[model samples]
Target: MVDRTPCASTTAFAQMAGLDSKTPHPTSIVVHRQSRVLEIEFDQGSAFRLPFELLRVYSPSAEVRGHGPGQEVLQIGKRGVDIVALEPVGNYAVQPRFSDGHATGLYSWDYLYWLGVNQETLWNDYLKRLEAAGASRE
Candidate 1:
């Protein structure tokens, strides 16, 4: 029988050992304006293509997420938001400058992973919120 467990050298294995530095990091980042998507490939060989509108609405900045609980600003009318620039913030995060002049969000690696994992569910929730608030994303 073949053993399916990952080897010690694998990024997942390192994460299991509590070595934060050994976590999967992005190997490539591609921003495609034509598709309005940001593609990120990790060291684990997994890739996530995130939309610019989604990224803008879910920005990790205080202006979007707020400084405390129950303070999140509902992002609407961002269906056409664009990513103007992607700036590396050290080795831990990236600051995406949006066409709307928003540039404070610092999207960390962990946060990106979370976004990739929960994107669909979060998107549905956002849509529901917008609909309930009579907001139109035009």
Candidate 2:
């Protein structure tokens, strides 16, 4: 089963992140566990359904992103990962506790928006990287 908990409001999150008026904010967020996708609607008239695997592999936590450039750790075996919980972090971000026990990533509003906007490119890139590294998303 999945917990479709409510995330923080984009308006409040953007304000906490010190973003300007032109920035797009999330109007709604829905986690569809059956499909393993996160559907998000932006206030700027845009919407995206991001996959759970995408979010897991691209997590911005230090464990995944590493301490700096050239130190990223590739994620694997996350195709079946699920979000066990989603908690708000102040008003700027949300912390998701993935079933894999990864809970360190604090996905900020800006980062989430970026992920939604560039999901295709990012997905392609991730696939290429995995292939090059002789890895698999399974």
List ranges where model 1 is wrong by over 4 Å.
1-19
The CA lDDT at 66 in model 1 is 92
Give lDDT tens digits, candidate 2, residues 1-138: 986764568656555453646667778888899998888888888899989889999998999999999999989788899988888887567788899999999887778888988999999999999999999888
Whole-model lDDT values for every prediction: 0.84, 0.85
TM-score of each: 0.83, 0.84
Window of ten residues with lowest summed lDDT in model 2: 11-20
**What stretches of model 2 exceed 4 Å from their correct place?**
1-21
For candidate 2, the TM-score is 0.84
**Model 2: how far residue 101 lies from native, Å:** 0.4
